[model samples]
Target: MGIFLTILKILGIVLASIVGLLLLIILLVLFVPVTYKVSGEYGDKIGGRVKVGWLFASATGNIKKTDDGMDGIAKLKVFGISIKKIRLMGHDDTEDKHKVKPKKEKKNKKSGTGKAPDERTETGNSQMSDLENDLVNSPVNGLKNNTGAADTTGINGNVRVGETGGKADSINGNESFDIDGESDINKEIDRIFGTGDETPEEDKTADENSGKTADEDVNKTADEDSEKEKVGIIEKLRLKALKILEKISGTKDKVLDKKDTLIRKKDHFIEFLDKPYTKNTIARGKKLLKKVFKNLLPRKGNANVLFGLKTPEKTGAMLGKVCMFYPLYHKWLHITPEFYEKKIEADLWFKGRIFIGSMAIPALFLVLSKDFKRTRNLAKKI
Candidate 1:
């Protein structure tokens, strides 16, 4: 009885250990999901728009924004992501260092009109000088304003032409204002520094000389007109020849279309007769028909030369043999009595028409006629 009690006690302790281990495993599974959620949230801050799929617990980091934009830093997941800072620089500072000082305004010189020239020249000179300095400092911006036709003098200053003590225009000194109401200095500088218009002027002079020469040839213009008329006549003849060739091609196309249609219809009729006939006899009939039809029918184009009984001699001979001996041909066709009777009737009707319209009387007349001597005389003249 004591041994049995000891066994029961040992079994109870073993069962209790098994339940405790199972509970511990369930707790670990639940805790693992929570740990994953926390790690994913931290990873969001460290890697902008990117996720670390399986990072070690010891690894991880954050990003910071600077004056310019966002900057990425080292984190445990990324280990080695790097970024650098940028700075912007410009050219105005160097340009201003090189500009010359503005010159002092000179006293006005007197002219016969009793007006002081200095009144016109003094302020305009200073303003123009300031503008030049500004253009030197910021060439790109100045160029934009000038090209856009915006006010391009120095800040709040107006620039006027023909009011300066500088060298005057050679042709018209101080006589007229510049077209753009600005100083003539720009135009003078362009004339001196920019490419001159010599080549374009030379081209215009040559064109004028050629025009004069063409006008001098006007007295003999009737001869030239006659030559042009001859050329036009040749072109018209060439075009007419091309049109004739095209018409021939169109006729060929029509002949081909007719031939293909007739061949397909004949094939269908042949197939209908085949089931009633022996294979060997049917094959022979089809072969003979194919050879005869090919010989008689036009091979190309729309117009059948054989239309309205117009076949050449070789075609006529093959067709003639087939029509004249059709009873013997039908023996080779080997069709049943009922089908053979119908086919023979159709062939007879077709042959009667052929002999009356194409072969018997008129063919005999042509054979017996004595017109060859006249035809030969006509050919000799040609």
Candidate 2:
């Protein structure tokens, strides 16, 4: 009975400890601010590192473009000690991809299961000798083996070079070897022509078609001229005048439409300026914008920048627009915009931090503002 009671007490203590640990973790997650820092440079590509830590753990990673998809690596640390690493964005393929491969060692020809150099040469020489022997035993090569000069007088066709007036005789049809400069070229040309006519048939056909095609073209041109003669000068003049009048009338109608549209736009803009809501709306927007910046934008920040636009007038106009936001950002933002040059070059570094928990009340106030609600409703009506 006493052992049972003691076991129960131990179990109760364990349960209470687990519950206390859970509560402590929940409180830490709710109250502890998760801090983050981001820093990088910008040129042709955008690259940066983001570090986020809550309580004791943090992650830092860079995401960039890749051939297949996004490629990134991150390190996770616990209590300031690296506990794990993310490879190729959570893939196991490691840094070995960039490592140089060791070259393969060339094997010795005399190694195990391979023939030595002397034996290999002996085998190659024996093979060549055997091939020569086989060729000598053949009937065709027997004559060459027994005689130095080749026998030309055979059954297929006799060149009869011993009797052809010091010239090779034609073999099989009119084919023969060129012993001298004047070969069977004339006979070959005659065979290709296959006729005794001075001019070839192909040239005769081409000449025949040439005159016929030229005559047909001239006839077509004459027919076109006769057809054009059927139309009177008065009819052509009337058609050209009609086309010109149509183009002029179309341009005049476009001009009148543009003038009417401009007049309507001018009158509408003037009426909008005279309304009382315009001034109220502008003032309300400025007030709301100030509140939003105070809540969302970090007041403490630093940046270095060089920027430009296409033209000097455009640069000045954009500069004024940028100043409407937190005016102090100009001090840290060493902004030099091109006034005369027309080129794009950017060198930028920005660093800032914002507390997510601190913006709660200001966000609520901005959302519940009477003017913001009225403005949204007015926009819907418009």
Candidate 3:
């Protein structure tokens, strides 16, 4: 009997220690801070850091763009000891800078009055008409002079006048007097009006070269326009992708805000639980507990629980009712009892028996027993 009592005392101490350790772990998990800091550009620059913990902790990295490339560093620590460290370096293409020339303004020619110059024909009709009149009047004047010379020559022919008479007679004998005059007039007309004939080979070649150059210029302009259109399309796609990313980031920020609100609410509830109990505190606790449980538990026909435990006076009775009526409790006990109003006595042989039975017993069994794999296989079969 003495040995048995000693064993029970030792077991009680071990269970109490385990319960304290578990509570400490739970407190640490609930209270430890996890912080993050992010600052930098999206594409041209980027950097961030994240830290989790109070004592046994972990931290993460930062990366940023430089003039030449990318550089970064990351570190991990456990129990104030560096467990892992990493460094990163990379390169990216740099932007190109180009010199741009300013455009020159075109100058418009102006007349003496300062208005733009009027269009004028380079070949004047008045000058051409004057040239035609001179051509017509000169033929008549040459004919009159020839006839007068003929009359003089005839008069000299009768007298046999001198060397001048001899030259005039020789001109009349060698050629028809009218033929020479007509030949001179034809030559003058030909000089004034060019012959309607085929163009020269040099002029034709020059025209063909000009046409080819114009076609080449048109093709080059078309190619440049196509390239510009392609670039514009690429820019539009890039902008669209950026817009989508912005929308996703906005949604992520909204979710984070909601999560932060929930975390704050949890912290408030924990603080409230640490305060002394009173009528107002109990009422507020009831409300907070109902809200939390409503969120955690499934609702019945769109309605959460409308009732709560009134105070510590009724706590035992409420727990008893829950154990009696709750489906989970009935399943665990594998039995149902008739309704009754009798007081039920509950007793524990050890001080930490509740914690040992609920947590340590199952945990120790899993760690020590070799039946975990068999149990897992059986669960899978089920």
TM-score of each: 0.17, 0.36, 0.23
Output the lDDT of residue 302, model 1: 18
Writing each residue's lDDT as its tens digit, candidate 1 over 1-382 gives 9999999999999999999999876554433321111111111132122222222232223333444445543334333443332222222345688999899999899668654788879878999999998776541233223432322343333332233342322222334333444344456667788756668889799999999888878746978999999999999999999999999999999999999988977775565445433343445445655644544432222111111123345445545655676684443222212211212111110110011222233434433444433333433443
1-382: candidate 2 lDDT, tens digit per residue: 9999999999999999999999887666545666666666565665567787887888888766555555677889999899887764524455578779999999868648788899999999999999988765543321222222333543355543321225544545466553432224334656887647656787889999998999999999999988787766768899999999999999999999999998977776676555566556667566756754654554444566556776788889987887787475765566667777665544444344444434444455655767556555655543
What are the per-residue Cα lDDT tens digits for candidate 3 across 1-382? 9999999999999999999999988765544433333233332234434443344776666676666667776788888788897775553223123445678989988658543333233346567889887665441333224332322323113211122223323323443222333344445666787653657886799899999999999999999999999999999999999999999999999999999998977776665545443233445445555544434332211111122334544655665676666674332222222234332221111110012223333444454544444334433432
Q: Give the range of the ten consecutive residues with the poorest summed lDDT in model 1.
A: 345-354
Candidate 2 C-alpha error for residue 93, in Å: 11
C-alpha lDDT of all candidate models, in order: 0.46, 0.65, 0.52
Q: After superposing candidate 3 on the true structure, give the runs of residues whose Cα lies further than 4 Å from its correct spot.
A: 41-46, 87-382
Error of 2 at 23 (Å): 1.0
How much is the lDDT of residue 158 in candidate 2?
A: 51
Q: Over 4 Å off in model 1, which ranges?
A: 1-214, 218-226, 229-237, 253-257, 260-264, 267-274, 277-382
Model 1 CA RMSD to the hidden true structure, in angstroms = 40.3
- Candidate 2, superposed: residue stretches over 4 Å from native: 1-5, 44-46, 63-72, 87-299, 326-334, 343-382
